[model samples]
Target chain A: MNARARLLVFALGALLLGGAYMAALSQLAPLGRGASAYADILNRVCVRERHITDVVTAVNFDYRGFDTLGEEFIMFTAVMGAVLLLRRGKDEVQAPQEDELTSRRGRRRSDAVALAGVVFTAVLLLFGSYVITHGQLTPGGGFQGGVIASTALWLVYLSGSYKVMRQVGPKPLVEAAEALGAAGYALVGLIGLFQGAAFLQNTLPPGSIGSPFSGGTVPLIDIAVGLEVSGGFVLLLLTFMEEVLEIRLH
Target chain B: MLNIFCYSIAAWVLLIGLYGVVTSRNLIHLVLCLSVMETSTYVLLTLIGYRVGGTAPVFADIPVGTKAVDPVVQALMLTDVVVEATVMALLLALAVQAHKRTGSLDPHDLRALQG
Candidate 1:
């Protein structure tokens, strides 16, 4: 259709949407005691008496921990597959040197940025550890913390070169960490089985509600997840930047 | 009405993604669009399952007052987000390889891989 027709159609659609939203709002019960009554009921019957964070922890680590395991593996395999697919052949020429190493257009980083990146990497490392350790009690968790950790290398890469990234981002070390993380996750489930509980079931003592180590298997799993996620994301990004972005080391 | 809102948003996302996949010459754009579509559906699904004015599932502090929102959907979304992220990363990697092999980012140029 012509542009005018398209504009008319868009306007009509917006009008219809506005009308529908108004109708829905009219149907919705007014916000008052009735609307919040559910919250009051929960407070009196359940939440006011029990600790909400503990239950969230249990659900995340125990009840549905198996799913988290699978999620971690998904990340792990993606990184592995990316690396495998993107590896350069032995005879392939090393990417020729570029002048602007710090360009955001791709992975190219300037020398000055590379120097500053080392400092940023240290910050990310500390922040990531803090997130993973406090995951059980805070809004941040292993997965989020792991990504933050992995992103530390981007600065390192930007500041200097892939050499810097490789030195600190050692693939062998990352691989070992990934493997251990996976094993730790599995071991947690095995412990549950050995205790005669369901697989991935929380058998460890929950400790006190607000304590750092209070969430039993949740904190342990969080640590494992943190490692796996960080390793996986870094690996994936490295593979892509190396292969697709074609950032040369020399 | 809420269902309609959720479904419409889901449809809009899917259609926009479909358009991007079909019309975009760049492989990376296609993957990005696909992620956008996936995110839209996730939001729709979460909204469909949400209890209006419902709180998160967990009775950590209360004896037993509020009915918990569906933990199943929240848990599933967590898994879904991770899976989608993995898939997108892999797709981007493949797109890179395709670019390297063909010296082009257009999907129309990638015929060697096809039977």
Candidate 2:
């Protein structure tokens, strides 16, 4: 058999083996469809007593909040690492002349592309704000919204040049926002401790459930986390793009 | 019905991502493929939590709600999206830097530190 066919056959065999392994594991499950107590809890309890919204938010900011905190830290670390590793070395910065890299050749975008970019960036900014603000009430929340907001800058980058990206993404501004966002995230956890609850406890009033401000510390945490993430990702991407572009100063 | 659609789409997204990873020659494309792969997991998790035609899991909708999706999955996916973006950003940056020094987008040519 030819190399390609051999590879395909090997892959198919592996997939079948994996499926069999998973099926075997499935047989090990308890012989019940659902938990008896959980079903009882679902059926016997009144809706208010069940308190689904509060339960969710509580779990979010409390039970698994440490995981959320760690996620924010991961973003922070990734961005910082990117900046440190790809930053222009002093030698590269001082080099007399560097060869220009190949990218897109002479393809200048039409004005319509530029206009669409501007419109899309605006829509992303507004949508991100909406997502963050209405996080408690909707599926989209702070982190998702924040990434969306930050990626809007890439739209700007694609529209114009590195200069436009740099103008909006100065190192100091992004760094400060990132730092503040982290501090804010930590403070949310601390608030629970201050209120005699465990760390990252959902201590704040849950408020009226459907209100924009109902999720208590969750919304605040979401916004803080969003800001930090957006700032971080933008910095990381731009730093890399600039390195690739290998801009040389006169 | 929506759940089945969600599941099918999730599978499709994952397959498309795998295809990208397998076929891509450019470093940027590989990084983007990884992002797409991560996104498929997001879709799968979110769909698993979804109740068909369910309202948002808030008090306003809870009164008339038949079932609610899992908020934990939503929160988890939200965090994952941020993490993915950050990681993708870093990967793209590294790819750019590698290109600058060695001058190529193809991964096969990036053997700069080989001793």
Candidate 3:
């Protein structure tokens, strides 16, 4: 189509969309004042049942835990798909000699960059652990913390050669940890099942609300999810990096 | 008035993303446009969840009678964000493979499947 016609069509489409959106917005109940169907119920029950301060965590891991399980599997499947798509094939030429490739491509390490990477990695790892463990008490949780933790591995890749990264995090070990993390989450849910409760039921005792030890299986699920996310992200990065390095063939 | 503003802005963002996707020549640009659409949804949900004078829903240091913003939408948005990230990563990976196989990033050029 001509540019004029295309622009006219686009304008018409936008106008229609705007009208539809306005209509929908007009029908929506007033914000903040509109009563949620189950907010009050959840608010009352969540604190009492989970004894957790962060109601969001309670909702995610307990109230709607089955949904969270599906979310975890979504991540799992996406990473698995990435691995399958990016894996080195039989026709791809493997690096015959690691030392030769390193000597050829590896630049002299910058002390400043290496030092900064190490400091940042350490800080991120600690913060990630804190976020994952204290998920029930704080605003952040496993997903956020896991993404942060994976950045440490990314920094390792940035500051050092592939060889150093391999030494620090072997591919097989990371993959296994990813699988284990996903499985561990499922296993936690199964415990609820074996206890004659619903899947992902909060079987363990929820301790005092504010303490780190509270939230029972919530914290454990958070840890498992954190591990899975960190490993998945790191693996995704490694595969792309391998492609960049020509370690994997086109 | 504030609700109108927030909702309109969200709609505008979504429309802009849609326009970009419709006109995007490159796959990477299309992916970015998709992200913009996702972000618009996030903004809409957040705005919907906001209370006029409510504080965060956390029980830390707040008065007993103080109103707090809705926590359910926040929880849902959290999961949505993770899903968006995963989907983006997968799309980029597929884009990489497409480029490797076809030697082009343009949707027009990637017409092998077209009948």
Give, for candidate 1 chain B, the lowest lDDT window spanning 10 residues: B58-67
lDDT scores in order: 0.66, 0.66, 0.81
TM-score of chain A of each: 0.69, 0.76, 0.88
Cα lDDT of model 3 by residue, A1-250, tens digit? 6556766798899999989997898676676666675765666566667877777887888788889889889989998888787767676775635663353365676889889998998999999999998888878778889989988988887677677776788889889989988998999999888989988998988998788989989999999989898998888887776766655563
Candidate 2 vs 3: which has more TM-score: 3
Ranking by TM-score: 3, 1, 2
TM-score of chain B of 3: 0.92
* Model 3 ranges off by over 4 Å: A1-10, A96-109, A248-250, B63-65
Q: Least accurate stretch of 10 residues (summed lDDT) in model 1 chain A?
A: A43-52
Candidate 2 backbone collisions, by pair: none
Per-residue lDDT of model 2, residues A150-229, tens digit only: 87998987776556666777768988888888889899889989999888777787666567777667878878877887
Candidate 2 Cα misplacement greater than 4 A, ranges: A1-13, A20-59, A94-124, A155-165, A246-250, B1-25, B50-59, B62-65, B101-115
